[model samples]
Each structure stands twice: as structure tokens, then as C-alpha cells.
Target: MPDLLVEHHGVQVLVCSADGATIATEQDALDHLVGAAFQGAELVAVPAGRFDDRFYDLSSGVAGAILQKLANYRVRLAVVGDISHHMGTGTALRDLVREANRGRDIWFVTDLNELTTRLAPRP
Candidate 1:
């Protein structure tokens, strides 16, 4: 499915529907960041399952690399879906998810609604 453009807190966000695509590598992350920019979107919401399993592995550094790329491009990222399973495996991974969710640049949310709420302008 095609990406849906939505507005939140006056920001344009590209919400990617599950398309059977896996964002497993740095290249995939880069491609999405560029695509988001091309679509005039400041943020991109991707389903968690779209990411490769290695992304949740801290030693693999996949998640960190992808996040770095997004940050470099000044593109916000929202990873939506259930990640409780991945989080259960390690404290490091869980810590990473927690830290990312606490920041504005990257967020790990349970659903699209939560993503939108997190992106909403705060008073």
C-alpha cells in the first residue's frame, strides 16, 4: 500500500502502510528518509514488523545505524507496532527503546494513534 500523508501538530507525517517491505538495512532506512522528504513529510511512521529482526539486536547495531541516518536527515521516525516480544529479550534493547521513545527524533509506539499523539504539539 502507498504511504498516507497526515497532519499532526502542524507537521506533515508520512504513515507507511504495511507493504511487505522489510527495512532491515541502513540503505532501507536511507531510502525511506529520502522518500519522506520527497513527499514533503517531516516524519515517517513505519510498522515494527517491517524492520528486520537484527534491528532489535543491540550488538547488530542495525537500529542505531538506521536511527542515525534519520537523525542526520532531520527526519523524525515513529516505529509502530507491538515490540514487547523484542523488548523482553534484553535490557539493552529495552533501554534503547525507552530512550528513543523519550526523544522527539525517534519514537517506538504501540500504534498509529499513539504515534500521532506523541507527535502532537505540546502545550
Candidate 2:
């Protein structure tokens, strides 16, 4: 199925439904952002599998570039699915996820419920 917009926590999110497609480059990331923009989506949800294995390698620069593009476009990004295993690959990647999760612009969540909570209002 193609990307579709869904409301979660009252936020319009464009979900990338392309299963098994590896988003390994900045262009691939940009494509999703563009699709979201076109759909007037305020946020984006992408499955963890959408990202290539290299994205976990901090030195590869894939993750940084993708996240940067999302920020540049003012689009919130949520990487959905369990990435706890990937967290053990290296300190840089683990630190990156930790830092991103601490902010509002981007997040790495284990499931859709966590994604909603992450985007929900905090008091």
C-alpha cells in the first residue's frame, strides 16, 4: 500500500506504508517528506524497516541526513517498531536515539502507542 494520512492524537500524520523498501539515502528520505508535504501532513510515521541497515551506523551519515531533511522541512518524524536490538550496535547510534527521543521534532518508538504518547501534549 502507498503512504496514507491518518489522525493520531489529533495530529495528521502521513504514514509510510512501503514495506521492505530501504530508505538509504537523503533523496529517499526527501521523497517521503515531499509526499507528506503534498498531503498536508503535519507529521510522518515510518516503520523501522524502511530505513537501511546503514542508518544504524552513525558514520554512514544516512540517519543524520534523513533527520536533517525532515527538520529542514519542519516535518515531525517518528520511527516506529522495536529498535532495541539496533541500540546495541554502537554508542553513537544509541546516543542519537536517546537525544532524538528527548526532543519533539523526531523520535524512535517501539510502537504506535508510544508514537502517540510522544506526540501528545505534556503538562
Candidate 3:
């Protein structure tokens, strides 16, 4: 299936295909951001696997660059998938995930279900 625009809890999101081209550079990430914005998406949800492995490595600076670009445009991002392997690699990754999850701009979730839950409206 192709990337699609979906609504959850009244917010429009661009859900990227898991099998799509890997985002390995800042330009690749910018492409997705522009596409999502064109589709009127308030947020973009990309399968964690779609991101290059370097993204999970803080020293590589890929994640920070991509996320900063998105945040600069006020576009929220949700990385969806199981990243336990990456998390187990180091405390930096684990801490980053923990911190990102606590913010409204970025989130690291296990799956779409968890993404949905996080986007759900609360009383």
C-alpha cells in the first residue's frame, strides 16, 4: 500500500508505508515532510524500519537533523515500530525515546495502536 493520509482524534496524519524507500539522509526526510505538508497532514507517522539505522545512533546526528527540520516547521513526527533492539544498544537511545515520548512534537511508539492511543482525546 502507498503512503496515506488518515485522521485520528481529529488530527490529520500522513502514514508512511513500511516498505517504502528508506530515509537515509536529511534530504530524504525533507521529502517526506514536504509531501505530508502538501497533503494537509498535521503530523507524519513513519515506521521505524523506514529510517536508516544511523538515525538511531545519536552520534550520527541523523535523527536530530531530521527532527529539528520537522520541529522548525511545527510538524509533529511519530516513529512507529518495535525499536527494542536499538534501545537495548545504549542508554542514550533509550533516554532519547523516553524523552521524545513525553513531548508533543515527537513520539516513539511500538505500533499504530500505540500511536492511536497517544493521539486519543482525553477528558
Compared with the true structure, what per-residue lDDT tens digits does model 1 show for residues 19-54? Answer: 757888889887765565568888888888889999
Q: On TM-score, who's better, 1 or 3? A: 3
TM-score of each: 0.92, 0.89, 0.95
Considering every candidate listed, which one attains the maximal TM-score?
A: 3
Worst 10 residues of 2 by lDDT: 29-38
Winner on lDDT (2 vs 3)? 3
Residue-level lDDT for 114 in candidate 3: 90
lDDT (CA) per prediction? 0.83, 0.81, 0.88
Off by over 4 Å in 1: none
Q: Which lDDT tens digits does candidate 2 get at residues 16-59?
A: 88564678888887775655556878888889988898888889
What ranges in model 3 sit over 4 Å off? none
Query: Per model, how many backbone clashes are there?
Result: 0, 0, 0
What does each candidate score in C-alpha RMSD? 1.3, 1.6, 1.0
Better model by lDDT, 1 or 3?
3
